[model samples]
Each structure stands twice: as structure tokens, then as C-alpha cells.
Target: MKPADIDEFFRRLAADNPAPKTELEYINPYTLLVAVVLSAQATDIGVNKATGPLFQIVQTPGQMVELGEEKLRQYIRTIGLFNTKAKNVIRLSEILVAEHGGEVPRKRKELEALPGVGRKTANVVLNVAFGQITIAVDTHIFRVSNRTGLARGKTPEEVERKLVRYVPARWKPHAHHWLILHGRYICKARKPDCPACAVRDLCAYPDKTSERDMLEDPPVPVPAG
Candidate 1:
């Protein structure tokens, strides 16, 4: 997309939702870290359902250590990788208690050192919990970036880098949430609602689907904008 298109695209998104936030529910950075770690390959709704009960009882590293791996599995068993995730959650909690004084570390390297906390998880925690501008390119964001031609790339890292370079500085803070929500609800993988898309005119996907008649076209300048 051109500079003007990219600028207006994010401007409209920010205007629509001034203060977008992660769908995952958490009380603090500690719980946010755990929620992001458990959210891999799972929906926000599913994670929130499990964590709602889990966090009530185990909000801190010391509390999580007391909860134990076996009981943790019982709470999150409905999730995709409960067995492994339970083990990692407990192990990381112990690490936090021993190393970081039971607080979620602010630095990405320290967060990544925790068990089961990968690049994406660390990025999410760093951004949403710590007020960082980093983008955690989840599947939804990755798909949207490629499909919209907003920051097209074959790999998530490439798309992330391109987004950092392309998106205006003013929009960087909440850009991740805007794109992710848009992909999840509007620019869907199966059949995009092009007619209702905010950036349909700017999007360059060749096969963008729309509910309108094929012969009809959206308003634009004659031959050029």
C-alpha cells in the first residue's frame, strides 16, 4: 500500500476503536503472562474460560507453585495442550518466584527464558502488559497482513518487520489489535466481507470476495484517486 493509504487505513482503525486491547482477560502482568503462554493454538474465549477460574485461585507465582501441575491440568484440561501447558506454567511460575521475585519480567529476553514462552508470547506480554509498541503477529494478524497486501510476506517475521517499517508511528501502539480484530471478524480467510471492509479500496488481494454485484464498483476517482 502507498504511504497515504497506509496512513488513512490505520487512522480509520484507530478512530473506530480508540483504545483497543487484548481479548484475553487478566488482572495483572503476572496473569497476562500466563494467559498468553496458554493461548497458543487456542481461542481467546477458551483461554479466558479456563483462566477465569484458574487466576481466581492462582494469581501469583507462589500461588501457582502451590496449585501444582496435576491440579493445573484439571483447570485447563479443556484447552488444546493442557498437559504440556500445565507443566510449563508451573515450571515458569517457579522460575519467576526464584528469579524475578514473583513478578513477570519486563524485558523480552527474560520473558522468553520462561518455559513455553516463545517469541510471540513474549511479544504479547511485552506489548499489552508492559505498554510496548511491539507487534505479536498471531495467525490472524499474519493472515490479514498477507491477504490485505498491507505488509505482505511469506513468513510472520517478515510481515512483522514490514509492518513496523510501514505503519505510521502514531498508529503503532494499537495496530496489532486493530489488524487482528479486523481479520478475525471482517477480512476472514474463508470469505472476506469486502463490501463492508474499511480498507477494501486500498487492499490489493486479487480474489477479495464481496457480496455486491460483480459489475458494480465502489466509488473512486475516474481512472485514479
Candidate 2:
């Protein structure tokens, strides 16, 4: 999209949700990191359901380490890949306690060094927990970016790079939240609600779906600007 359109896209999103926040619940950076890790391949609502009681007991790395793998598994057993996630959580908590004095690290590299914490996880931690201008490209953000022609790329990293470059500085800090929420609620995967979309006019998706998308033969093509 052109620079002006890109700015307008975010402007509408921002206006609709002036203070967008992660749907995942957390008390602190450590819990936030753990929530993001658990959120991999799982929904935010699902992760929150498991983490709600867990966070109350384990707020810091030391506390999480004390929770132990077996017990942690019991807590998150409802989530997918609970065994592996439990092991990673315990080990990463140990590392954090031993190295970072039980606090979540602000640096991206350090954040990624933790078990189950990849670039996307690190970006989320840096952005939501540390207030950085990083955009973690989840499935939602990736689809939204490509569908809207905002920052099309084959991979999430490529899209992240393009978004970092394309998004205006003023909107960079909140871009991730805006895009993710917009994608989740409006520009959905199976069928986007183009008619209700705030940025429908600015979106460049060739085929824009609406409320009757499920019953329709094909979605209507968006008109040229």
C-alpha cells in the first residue's frame, strides 16, 4: 500500500481501539512471557483459562522454577503439547532465575534464548511487556497484512521487516496490537466481514467477504481506488 494509505489504515484502527491490549492475561513480564509461550498454536482464550490460576501462584522465574515440571504439566495439561510446554517453562524459568535475577530480559536476543521462545515470542514480549516498537507476525497479522496489501511477504519475518519499514513511526508502537485485533475480530480467516471493517475502503484484498459469505458462491471483488 502507499504511505498515505498505510497511515490511514492504522489511523482508523487506532481510532476504533485507542488503547488496544493483548487478550492474554498476565500480571508481570515473566507471566506475560509464559503466556506468549503457551499461546503458541493455541488461542488466547484457551491460554488464559490455563494461566489464570497458574499466574496467581507463579509471578516470577524463581516461583515458576519452584512449581516444577510435573506440577506445571498438571496446570497446563488442558493445552496442546502440554508436556513439552511444561518442560520448556520449567527450564526457561531456571535460566531466568540463574541469569537474569528472576526478571524477564528486555533484550530480544536474551528473550529468544529461552526455551520455546522464538522471534515472534520475543517480539511480543519486547513490545507488550517492554514497550518496544516491535510487531510479532502471528497468523492473524500475516493474513491481514497480505490480504490488505499492507506488507505482503512469504514468511512472518519478511512481513515483520516490511511492516517495520512501512508503518509510520507514530503508529509503530501499537501496530501489532491493532493489526492482530483487527484480523481476529474483523478480517477473519475463513471469511472477513468487509462491510463492517473499519479499513474496508483502504484494504486491497481482491475478494472481500461479508456477512453472507458462507451462503454466497464467491466474494465480491473490491473496487479499485
Candidate 3:
């Protein structure tokens, strides 16, 4: 998309949600990191449902470690790959306690060094927890970026680089949240709700679906009586 359209796209999204936030619920940075890790290959609602109970009991890295991998698995078993996620969470918690003094690291390198914490997860932790302007291009952001022509790229890293370079500096901090939410609700994969999209006018996608198109015909007018 053009630079002007890019700015307008974000402008509308920001206007709709002045204070966008991560859908994954968490009480603190430690819980945020764990929630993001468990969110891999799972929906935010699913992750939130599992983490809700888990976070109430385990806030700190030490507390998570005490919960143990097996017990953690029980809490998150509803999510995909729970066994692996549990193991990684437990190992990362151990590292956090031993090296970082039981605190989630602010630096990307340190965050990514932890098991189950890749670049995307590290970016999320840095941005959400540390107030950094990093963009973590998950599937949602990736689809929206490419679909809207805001930042088209083959890989998430490429899209992230484009978004970082193109998105206005003023909107950088919250760009990820805006794009993710838009993709999840509006610009969906199966059928984008183009009629309801705030930035539909600025969107460059050729296959924009409309509510009118989904219906056989316009609704008949109601009688005055």
C-alpha cells in the first residue's frame, strides 16, 4: 500500500481501539511470557482459559518451577502440544530462576535464549512487558500485513522488517496489537469482513468480501405499519 494509505489504515485502527492490548491475559511479565509460549499453535482464548487458572497460582518463575512440568501439562492439556510446551516452560522457568534471578528478561537475545521462546515470543515479551516498539508477526499479523498490502513479504521476519521500516513511528508501539486484532476479526482467512473493516477503503486486497455479496439480495424494506 502507499505510505499515505498505510498511515490512514493505522489511524482508523487506532481510533477504533485507542488502547489496544494483548488478548492473552496475564497478571505480570512472567505470566505474559508463559502465556505467549503456550499460545503457539493455539488460539488466544484457549491459551487465556488455560493460563487463567495457572497464573493465579504461579506468578513468578520459581512458582512455575514448583508447579512442575507434569502438573503444568495438566493445566494446559487442552492446548495443542501441551506436553512440549509444559517441558519448555519448566526449563525456561528454571533458567529464569538460576540466571536471571526469576525475572523475565527485557532483552530479546536473553528472552529468545529461553526454551520455547523464539524471536516472535521474544518480541512479544519485549514489546508488551518492556514497552518496546518491536513487532512480532504472528499468523494474524502476517495475514493482515500481506492482505492489506501494508507490508507484504514471504516470511514473518520479512514482514516484521517491512512493518518496522514502514509503520509510522508514533504508532509503532501498538501496531502489532492493532494489526493482529484486525486480522483475527475483520480480515479473516476464510472470508474477510470487508464491509465492516475500518480500513477497507485503503485496503489493496482484490478479493475483499462484502456482507452484501454473502446475501442473495438486499433485505426487503419493512412496511411502515
Off by over 4 Å in 3: 214-225
Model 3, 12-53: lDDT tens digits are: 888888888888899999999999999999999899999989
RMSD of each: 5.9, 4.7, 5.5
Q: Give the 10-residue window scoring lowest on summed lDDT in candidate 3.
A: 216-225
Better of 1 and 3 by lDDT: 3
Q: Rate the local accuracy (lDDT) of all candidates.
A: 0.86, 0.90, 0.89
User: Model 1 over residues 1-225: C-alpha lDDT tens digits?
Assistant: 888999999987776667778889999999998999899999999999999999888889999999899999999999999999999999999999999999999998999899999988998998898889898899999998888778989888999999999999999988988888888777766667776678888888888775663235433211110
What would you estimate as the lDDT of candidate 2?
0.90
How many Å off is the CA of 182 in candidate 1?
0.7
Residue clash pairs of candidate 1: none
> Which candidate leads in lDDT?
2
lDDT ranking from best candidate downward? 2, 3, 1
Better of 1 and 2 by TM-score: 2
